[model samples]
Target chain A: MTAPNGMRTMLGRVRGLGSAKSGFAHWWAQRMTALALVPLVLWFVISIISLVGADHAAVSAWAGQPVCGALLIALVIAVFHHAQLGLSVVIEDYVHEEAPKIVALVLVRGLAGLLGLIGVVSVLKLMVGS
Target chain B: MDARKRPLSPHLQIYRWQITNSLSILHRMTGVALSVGTLLLLYWLAAAATGPAAFATAQAVIGSWIGRLLLFGWSIALFYHLCNGLRHLAWDAGYGFSLPSVTKSGMAVLGATAVLTLAAWIAGLVI
Candidate 1:
């Protein structure tokens, strides 16, 4: 195989580098989230449409149903997870500074966690009639 | 990283406008858009967890014309991104590599995105 340049070769760069498998995984997750989101998004659209004429309590109560709560929880969780993964790629692409990249990634992960908690707790509150 | 100079393929300017190009670029565009939109989502989530006033304030922004416009844009971006992301998934699975097939599916993604976005907005108006 021909070497790419001064210090690197094409095969060396492509061979089991940090970018292949995880590259596919990142791409896969984005698409997976996109696929997972189809029905979830449709359900959310329907829910939002229903909420148009609803009062606050009505909105909360409607969301408080078991099925609805379950879906909403899934929606938020999927959303946050998808967001984190997407942003991670973006950060990895654009953020050249090492420390900031790690920081931003951690921040995204933390934000995802917070959003997940909010989603789960909200669903629980809706579930127990609280 | 390969820092060596090599013969390059024709760039964007060299090729005629194609659906695949449009859709592929749109994916990146929507990614950036959704990055901003996520902040809005965060606002929504925080408001939902907060008191009624806070939630209403958030709702009020969404109820406004600017908010609606942004939401509308976000909606389209969402659907476009979703469709193209699926297209990407198919590619990753070792499918749709042919140029003709790529263009065909890319058009489908664009068409689906527009249809869904318009339908959603219409549905919103009706309800």
Candidate 2:
């Protein structure tokens, strides 16, 4: 059977390629994280601004609050997850070499995870130590 | 196949600079900047968790001139990324696809980002 253009069959046009299987999950997760980050980041900016010129004790106290700590942990997780997804796309776009692309993707994920862990642990410590 | 000899589509250099194009690229640029800026947030949190002395040192560094500059840049980047990300979400939802809507939304995002960054800084300084 010929396609409308008579160049190839309809199945030939679509065969061997339907879905990558993981692209949608990455995209949906990116959007979900962005949605979560909107409120989290706005609250964080306002809180941090209000704490400007505040002493270490004051800042610690603010961070130690149950609500603040929870939101902060949420923000950190969302930010890093979003960043990892974003940087991975950037690397994939610009880094053509297969090996370097994989390396960069791994490095970005590792760094994002490490920093995110530090943020969560730090917030937890402030809550416990305060 | 010799990749160098392959026919290539029009590249960025072929297009005239425009608001929509600029804003689209700026979104990606700000995203990357904000990614690096996350380190500053992590440092602050780590210091706060450490002790008063460490917190003081962190404050000192952040309070310095260069620190303020970096903070200013990060704040701008954050606001830009946030605003544009919203615009992206709207696009994803299948609204504002027309050329005029796209351009108008781009301008609105820029306006919002500027207002937010400045307002935050002013509030930070005055309050």
Candidate 3:
């Protein structure tokens, strides 16, 4: 069978010698997350700055607001996701050893996921009170 | 795969330093630093969620001289990464590929980072 336009040849696809076929997805996701983070991070920095020197009660009250909690959660997810994607590239570029590279990738992904979860939970707790 | 001596591509040691190269490397460096800095953010959030005591502990750590210094560094890194990241995005979008344009954009990124970091710190301290 003939390969379709812009498609890999059947034999080439089967061999899989060159492309992973998923690099674009990773690249696109990184860019999308970066775009989302521009505003989210700006908002977070400004919010924290405004809350500088504020008491615990005030900070809690501010975080507890629905809008604030939602945005904070969004920020956390975007930050961790973007960070994971970025770090993965760095590891792949620097770590040439096959086994260690896999281990590092797994560790980075795990840490990113765990930290993102903790951030979400924290925001939720603050929203719920105490 | 057999372990064999092979001619590898030229790398950093061979190239002369330039703004483009410097900014590109700095971008990665800041990215790594920001990755580590996420821990501080996580700590603050967890502490805030825990209780007044925990939050106070976090505040004390973050308010200390060392903590402030780290924060200052992270802020600079963050702004630098953010601005250069936008420059990268512009390049990805097929803009600013010419040599002069690239250099100009690199300079602009540095300027933007400085202004943003300064503005953020000022706002943080003043407001």
Candidate 4:
């Protein structure tokens, strides 16, 4: 059933309040990434702890493991994505201007994506023993 | 618009201290700190992928006193963010909304963060 004459649906009302008219996706994605990071980050912290005082060869060998590379790649992606989402919230809250806000958001996303790529590539290089 | 002379919401300084309030602010603060710390992670990855000299240079910086201090702070921030993020996830799941529970969880998050951070540092020092 449709809403009566000019009455907005609940979703429609929410969509109206957001600047881009698409707030839910960002909110959901942030939560999803946060959930993914929980286990991945725990693994990362434990692995990093284990690698302490380890030499370059030892650390590289550890990273070269198939499981290690895959998980690290996943962690890098989730982490950067989550970081971008969280930073954008802070920026939007404090920036107070449209132009700079957009610029800051773009920069945050671009830099995060770039650094995430670099992280995955580095892991792959180690995995391939190159 | 009447925005030029509009009233504003009372800011932090005017408010009494509360657990939820401090944790809310700290959640954002830790997030921003961790974003900057990501650069250090990137550097380590890049250094590792490069030759021995590059890795050594990276290690030297990371092993320095200032670097250690930064690392400690970053670790604390990371743990705090992790704990608080989980608390937020619990909130998202429709639990911990009551005032008592919120206060308890907020304190628990902070307590967990401090303990975990100290444990991590001890492990680092030992290994």
TM, every model: 0.79, 0.90, 0.90, 0.89
Give DockQ for candidates 1 onward, in order: 0.28, 0.80, 0.81, 0.77
A1-130 in candidate 4: lDDT tens per residue?
6656458768775656767657888999999999999999889989988888777888788888999989989999998999999999999999998999999999999999999999999999999993
lDDT of 4 by residue, B1-127 (tens): 5568677876878888888888999999999999999889789878888867888888889899998889899999999999999999999999999999999999899899999999988886875
Q: Hey, what RMSD does candidate 4 come out at?
A: 3.5
Report, for all candidates in order, the number of backbone clashes: 0, 0, 0, 0
Q: Write the residue-wise lDDT of candidate 2 on A7-36 in tens digits.
A: 777788776576865788899999999999
Question: DockQ ranking from best to worst?
Answer: 3, 2, 4, 1
Q: What's model 2's lDDT at B17?
A: 89
- Chain B TM, per prediction: 0.87, 0.91, 0.91, 0.91
Candidate 1 lDDT tens digits, A68-119? 8888888887887887888788789889999999999999889778867876
Pairs in steric clash, model 3: none
Query: Cα deviation of B9 in candidate 3 (Å)?
Result: 3.9
Tell me the spans in candidate 1 whose CA falls farther than 4 Å from its real position: A1-28, B1-4, B8-18, B49-51
Worst 10 residues of 4 chain B by lDDT: B1-10
lDDT of 4 at A130: 36
lDDT of 1 at B24: 67
Model 1 over residues B4-109: C-alpha lDDT tens digits?
9998976867878766666666787798787677667556645655556777888888889998888889899888887787787788789999988987887788
The CA lDDT at B8 in model 1 is: 92
Q: What CA RMSD would you report for each candidate?
A: 6.3, 5.2, 3.8, 3.5
**Residue by residue across B1-127, what tens digits does model 2's lDDT show?**
6668777765877878899889988999999999988898789889999999998998998899998999999999999999999999999999999999998999999999999999999999976
